[model samples]
Target: MTKQITDDLAQALWETLLLHSTKGRLRYGDITAIACEFGLTTKAVTRVWKKGIRSMGDRVAAVVKAGWSRRGRKKSLQSQTRPRTTEDLIEESVMLEIMKCGGSNTYKIPHQHKDKLRNAGKLPTTLPCDVQA
Candidate 1:
């Protein structure tokens, strides 16, 4: 006569069978061996195998359906937003500062423009003397 198994025991047995099948490529004989080791019958092991296979198939089918739905959906508007480039604004600011110091060749103004600007901390000390204007 077949013994009644608890739900928890059945679940544990099912997981063990799945793990063994994955690792060793189990057959019905292997399932029977595992069932015997776990104090279960071959018929019980067969039931667990069937349940595990069905559950795995259902999970795979659900995932594939989800992927198909996502493939058919349109992307949100937020995903189309593009960030503005700061390159143009930065270049313009630098050009304006250079023009404020007069033409680029005004480094010939001796120490008046370059050294004064450096001493007042307005210009970087590393500014090349040739480009100071």
Candidate 2:
């Protein structure tokens, strides 16, 4: 995997490239000059510059600029604000009932039930009894 670039450096290079392009179209030589001025190799600068330009073109620069600071905050807030659906509630209740039915202690049950379930094709693809209790 490629190493990540710092936001400050990326932003600076993005602005620099944009300025260059606005005044006159940027070329490989311009990129090389900027890389030299920034004490970075041409390839490294090109990688960052291209990434920044792509991010800008796709209109995701602002979100990337913000990093993961607001990562799960909006999701949590939205979840708290919205009411759970009836289906969600029912599914949760069913899950709770399954948990209370000694689902985790299946090893205590006789092997006959497992064999019957397997024979009748009622068991899931993977047998729960094969897993830890």
Residue-wise C-alpha lDDT for candidate 2, range 1-133, written one tens digit per residue: 2334567766776677777875435865888888777777777677766666667678774322424344564545655553433344344444554565656543332233544654576744332331222
- The lDDT per prediction is 0.58, 0.57
lDDT computed for candidate 1:
0.58
Top-scoring candidate (lDDT): 1
Tens-place lDDT per residue, model 1, 1-133, is 3566666677677667766775535854788678778787887767766766776767742111111234556776986754343344444445555665785744332233544554576754232334453
Quote each prediction's TM-score: 0.39, 0.39
Q: After superposition, how far is residue 34 of candidate 1 from its true place, in Å?
A: 1.2
Clashes of each: 0, 0
**How large is the C-alpha RMSD of every model relative to the true structure?**
17.9, 12.4
Error of 2 at 44 (Å): 1.4
- Candidate 2's displacement at residue 121, Å, is 23
- Runs in model 1 deviating more than 4 A are 23-25, 60-133
